[model samples]
Target: MGNGYLRFAALGDSTTVGLGDPLPGGGWRGWARLLVESLQASYDVSFCNVALSGATAAVVREQQLDQALAHRPDLASLLVGVNDTLRSTWDPDRLHADLDHVAGALVDGGATLLTVRWHDHAALLGLPRVLVRPMAERITRVNEVYDDLHATYGGLRLDLALMPEVTDRTCWSIDRFHPSELGHRALARAWAERLCAAGLDFPLPSLEAGGGREPSWRRDVAWMVTEGAPWFGRRARDLGPWAVRRALAAAR
Candidate 1:
């Protein structure tokens, strides 16, 4: 694997699509790109990212996973489940089953799989105590599935939930949900380190550097109006009704 060119495919949602890490030409250069670049320094690497913003794990399994599998990558990364956590009708058992199917399919097809456990963003975002507890619990359940899957399969797991740096304000974009460019770079470095530790031959670099510049207040305000408000409105419209229904069901 080391001697030949590596084909890499990234799957999942907004994090994999790189929503917060804007590029000069309009698209994003997320952790996937960073990782490929790093690998290209030493080996020939072809990369594909089939992640869509606002995609759920089920959507990834139904839509993106097939496209990724078609690429027949030597390595693949799956970063999902956060969107599922926010859903009102989230079923952990179903999520786990879907995850297992995806992981098994990828590994069975001969790709080295990589996945992540989400950080405790509910707490970091300063949600109300009521909201935070439930959100945290949901995230915990999702991560437990991640742990189990990683244990059963020999995939690399980036335990971002345990990494304190992910919660830092500097690592988040204006939306406060997605990782900033710096955060993405940090994530890429972490992945590289894990791969190297697992015996992939590559030059190890310092992970502390390469933080991207912080956005200015003016840009922040513009984003709030243009991106943030619309995002919030959309979520409310889409998830609000489902949430109400779930609450009613619980009460019954």
Candidate 2:
């Protein structure tokens, strides 16, 4: 799509790029891509994915935001701040400014904002002591800022948190960081529901439409008891191409 052709332009990190579980394009197919297609079909719209790998909120603003702005989308979605916590790089001031820039730019382009937060679903239940505290803190801080920012920016909608089960467990396969095919679908569905609530109102690209029933991810997550899995000890990094590619293919 050309500049302005896309009604939505998504920004942020791996989640933005769909680094959940690689499908076919060296990138994964997750909620971000699903949201784009669903919005297009449900609203008769188009979108651009300007998501990059390893994007922190600061980097996203300084780098990707301008490129996304060039699309002049009718809507903009962002799920940043994960990396900030991962790298211990949280900066409330810069985050606020960049967030304003993103929202303001979207408004100028006649689009709305879709604000989101991502915390590893695994940070609940029996998560290790070290991991739980920091992760919880990050989620709290990020959500707080996100809520405040969206409140100030009228057309913005605060989407829900990540899929608890899929994220919290080893649903991703061996690496256990990004979402697996199943995990990606769960994420996509959750996102679709939020958009539907925001008035997608129809089922063109929604899971409620012709798409297969609740991809395995959502189903598996729903039933998981968190009783039989290894806990996350270290922070996560990016994934390999095979994984990313698998995710993209699934999305297509």
Candidate 3:
């Protein structure tokens, strides 16, 4: 029935496409996929991922935004701006404008929005930390803009860069710039919790306080922007929500 179905699309950059954690399966399992499997049972969800590996806000403004909109989804997610900051050699103002433009496009597309946070951790990763912190702050400024737009439009927004769980070096990618596989799982779990708190009523794993667990979905989201595929669908593979209910029943 229409009541049980949801169409979702993802638009952004490398993280959205799963560049940080490449799998041998030939498909990069990112956070969006985690989201897909998480909701597959409760909602007859169709997912379209149109994220590029090195997209800037400008690139998204020009290209992928249209592709995502074409999917006609009810739920849409974006994870852009890192490349905008990392590659902006012309003007900072332009980068900020690009952010606005892309967000505007998604809004126009009539999809509920979710924005990922930006971060830099070379310092925590044992690098000199001189590289991307300033860039990260500029990213922070842009994320604030994203926040305003989401609030104004009545949507969800967050920043992955300032997340506490990601301070540990283990969360960084092998290159120390992206998030690791573990980081992706944490991200998916967090976002599920966010949607739940927002009255989404989706299935989610319990957060354990001994490991920084709380009602705070923000911490998990802060760990990684990308969600890997292998980590998702673990509990709900093959079986329906009835299977999930059965598992819960057995646990009791």
User: Candidate 1, overall lDDT?
Assistant: 0.80
Candidate with more favorable, higher TM-score: 1 or 2: 1
TM-score of 3: 0.72
Which candidate tops TM-score? 1
Q: Write the per-residue lDDT of candidate 1 for residues 1-252, one digit (tens) a residue.
A: 446588898998888887667776567777787787788877788888999988887988999889999988889898899888877768999999999999888898889889988778688777545456667888999999889888888778888967766767777788788888777777888899998888776654434434334456787779789988897777567656765665567679
lDDT of each: 0.80, 0.59, 0.63
lDDT of 2: 0.59
What order do candidates take by lDDT, descending?
A: 1, 3, 2
Which ten residues in a row are the worst by lDDT in model 2?
227-236
Q: Rank the candidates by TM-score, best first.
A: 1, 3, 2
Q: Give per-residue CA lDDT, model 2, range 196-228, as digits (tens).
A: 676555443343322323234553453243411
Q: How many backbone clashes does candidate 3 have?
A: 6
Between prediction 2 and prediction 3, the one with superior lDDT is 3
Clashes of each: 0, 20, 6
